[model samples]
Target: MVLRLFVPPGEGQHYIVPKRPDPLGANATLQYVVLSSTALAAGYASFAARHERRIAPPTKVSRTALFIKASGRLGVWAIVVGAAANAYYHRGFTTVVVSQLVQDPTPPKLYEKTDKYTVEDGGLAGAAAGFIAFLPTLLMRRATVPWWTRMVGMTNIGAGTGVIAAHAYFQYTGERQKAMEELERQRSRRMLEFHYIFWDKLLMQRLDPLLQAYVRHNGIFRAYHVPAEVLDAPDKYGILSMPATEPSTTTNAAAPEHAPYYIAAPDWTEHLKALNTDFTQSEIENSEREKEALLKEAEYMAYQLSLKQHAFVHSTHTNDDDRQRCIRELQIMGIAYNRLRASADEADRRIFAGRQWLRQRAAMDANAPKASWLAEHPFIPDPEAHDPSMSIAEIRKCEDQFKIEIQVFESRVRSEVREDVEMRERWRRDLDEARTLLRATDGILWELEKKCPPKRDVGEVEVRASAVEETPKVEEPPKSLNPEKP
Candidate 1:
């Protein structure tokens, strides 16, 4: 397409000049068409960049958008420079096309002054290439531009462009920072969810298989040769089978919401001898039963809460609010469970200790020197003795208490030992009891065998001793009657 400029009458002898193609081997028309379209596109891209951040600046955003956005800004300046140059080249063209206006009537006697003051109204048509600048260049038209005019124009354009670039740089940096922060947040979220994948995906797909595999390998890691103390010995411990309270664990028929039954069981001590072993043992057993009931309820509560929490955890659930709520609920339930478990463990230890005390008491030898003393007065601590952690003041306090108690106990025991009774009856009773007890002791048999060796039965001994060569029969020296017990 040819660009035609028609000079009006008297401008340069009415004629039309068509712009020629550039000597650079490119069609002027094609260049203009391409530049016009691309320049418009560049403008639109710049406009969109204000909102899109040159295509959103996300890590996933391509760099090509930013490149284009930058190129567009350069294109705008290029267009401005090209338009300004073209307007300068055709500076005087508007003179004949515009309507001329004079300050006053064009008087016959003032014709030269009127012509000198002639103002050319370029209107909107000529202002397009002139940049529509506020400072009019209408009267300043000349074939050669003054150096200062060029400097002023250059300064204004450079300053305006520099201001735009500075603002854009700050905005771009802010947008990129926001993008980086958003990316960082996303990464953190993934990090948090990394472990959850096992529960959500792996477990969901093969939970049964996983559990079965666990069962298969469990025996390999299981303990063997468990000690007798750890095994529940109902008979030895003097505790009957614990009634199945699981069914009734949650039932609080008498108490409202299981408002705890109030009872404090005092510990074993000589001062409480009136209550007796039987009552103390019963209270311990009762406490264990109560703890067991509470443990069962807590376990049930925890299990139920666990199941509920598990339901909300899967990725399939869309409601985040419910899952968050279940998170807190499960924590509270876990706390309750742990509290009950600890209480139950303490109760078990107390009951086990009580049983141990009972067994020791029952097995004690009454003939032992301290047995009678211990029966009435328990906790006979050594006044001077203390744990390594005890302070001097604590030790002194204990010593004072122990001294008074020990004095009382020593005086009572002495008086009891020295008390007179019927002489004949006391002697006979003592003699009979001593004779019976002496007969029951295994040391009597040991002494008898030591004095007179038992006749060896060859057939009886040979049956079990077939594997060993027996020593030749000889008179063996007498051995000690008291051998250490296995």
Candidate 2:
């Protein structure tokens, strides 16, 4: 057993037994120890890198610095631990050699050989172990193993660490993908908004002059600012032009007179006035009043007025006094007729303005990017292989709908404006015919006055009073003058 440390002994050599147990522990196998330390070092490096990655900030600088710093620390630790392990084995083997050589009965020549074998075995084992410990560095050198996965080999610990690193990488990529999608969505939304904003702002700018004209042409507020002479002239004619309202004592008598309801151009002026008032109020107030209700009310009022005017104008039986009342009613209609004429002119102007606005904006849109650019952009490949470009479809759909709406709006505005023009022209022709008839009635009244002239000043006043009193009672023969109902 003692020669076992040096050389084998036969016939001349005795079967010697060990005096004491071997100095090195039975379980202290050099190869096993080297492998264990190598695995431990690899695990430590992987764990260190993973922990650092977890705690590090998401910024580029922080992550890059963390990897670089971790690699450096790992290298230093591997070097230190490798040196220590090598030194430990070397010392253990050297000590065993020295102790055995002293106790052995072997010659000095055998001692040199045993000591040489011990040193060489220990050095080789130490070198192999140190190389295993530094295996992580080699793995990290490759680009395929992500920066965070710096550890080498397929040991359980290394595998676990690699899984964690992969998980982190995938998470980062997913977050980046989401952010990119959000950015793309916002870009698409803005592009659609541009379509509306571009046209709407232009329309507003073009309508400024028309808005000023609307205020100027409508006499509501402007009436208050008119010259005193203009006000006085209308008041002077009030006695002749105004309809008299009186309650009749008899049941058969006509009810108290009021202005006849007629849907005329002036009626539209009132409707427009209400619309403008509501529009202005909406800007300044927080009212919840529905626009549709207000519009319906205006429309109903205009319809009722038109019916009343039609009934009065076409009535065939009316005395001189009733005819006089009709003349006064016509004066009110004349005022409305003038307003209608102004409105017709305004409508024509609006049609022209809208045409100009649409023309200019259409040209601008024609110059903008078309749908084909989205399908095959110059910068990117066919986007279909990646995420679907739903934005392109959305834009096209919105654009088509907008075009249809604009066309409908334009057609309606044109039709309505032309109708207003025609209606006002017809009103002017009717007014001329009515004036001719009024002059003939005045001439006949004058002739009757000359034929039955009053005698004296006191008697003339009594006669005038009697004439006014008898006027309402007198009924005229049925005679249709103008054939037209309106």
Candidate 3:
């Protein structure tokens, strides 16, 4: 049977006085929920969309994550809608089959059922007086029904209404932020402020000594979580998939007379591989090529990033131990820095030295404006200008500031890692932002290197002393054979 919107009024004021279509605002609950849900859903859609802007290769989160991130709030609101609708629907059930209904009229002095409260004097007093007559607070001491039951029901309705209102307002005006840009901005500010102090904390010194010879060698102090797509198929992200090179050379010289098969016993030779083929020269070339790869910016960055990722994702080391281990591994990347400088070729040696000098010059040339304590970009480092270092008190001040920042960061990370949905969204959004920045930075550096390549030839830069004019050769004082010790 189709339900009619308008129902005929019952015999005599079955609805309370000042009776309307919905005296308890029961009908209004449905309207309110619908409006609030619409507003909140719209707000959530807008908020989620803001985070989906393409960042080169955009974030490829899992389907489950996408679903939860998208529809979780909507589902919760749907439950509230169901509960409110069910409660209203059950009003008819309670009125017909559940509520204590009596047809008899009131007796004696009691005009109100709440005041009379006995089974014999019917609830027509409440019905005649309107629903307000049944209020628990109005009930007299003689009432059979407890005042608390009605009181509790009223409280629930009010609480649910308040919840709906709160959710609607909160969702509509809320701004969705990944906080990725903000994090990097803060990190940049910190590095800029404590330029020299935290060099060891992030292991930048280890990287700088090796990578400064390469172009666009600025430090990335933080490690970002690699997207599953990129991590699963690294080659797709332009990362080389080659395994570490295998040993291809024999231990001894590559002479047929001293070949492994010729020198070793037959039983031992049986175990030896590639006995017939000479691998010494190829192995040597492979080793050289491997050393040369140290100069490749992209490959070097990928390697460094992998170490950091492992420390964050897979490693068991905690706190300072993790940092120390990661840094030590990172330092190993620097051993190859001086390898080019040690080349026997004079031109090669000079080129490597020139590259090192270029790096030093860049660092020395970097300038920041001096500012007072309260000014913007305060305590900026002055490299070549030889500005005085921070005094003990200034150092202490910066350290205190850093401590506070660290605490805030720790709190944020803790919240994000827990099961808080909004926090998780923030984390995911930040992850996407971080990944985009990483890829974009690599792209920028790639373009920068293409435009202005490193110094490769010494002849072009070599300056010959003027031969036409006789330059005076000045001699210094002669020293004893033994040098003085400090």
- Which has the greatest lDDT? 1
Query: What ranking emerges by TM-score with the best candidate at the front?
Result: 1, 3, 2
Report, for every candidate in turn, its global Cα lDDT versus the true structure.
0.38, 0.36, 0.34
Clashing pairs in 2: 261-305, 262-305, 263-306
lDDT of 1 by residue, 235-256 (tens): 2333222211112112123443
* lDDT of the structure predicted as candidate 3: 0.34
Error of 3 at 252 (Å): 43
Once superposed on the true structure, which residue ranges of model 1 sit more than 4 Å away at CA? 1-275, 315-320, 360-486
- Top candidate, metric TM-score: 1
Deviation in angstroms for 5 in model 2?
94
Ten contiguous residues minimizing lDDT sum, candidate 1: 114-123
What is the TM-score (0 to 1) of candidate 2?
Answer: 0.15
* Model 3 lDDT tens row, 368-434: 2332212222355543343222232233343344345445434654673545644544444444444
How accurate locally is residue 48 in candidate 2, as Cα lDDT from 0 to 100?
A: 53
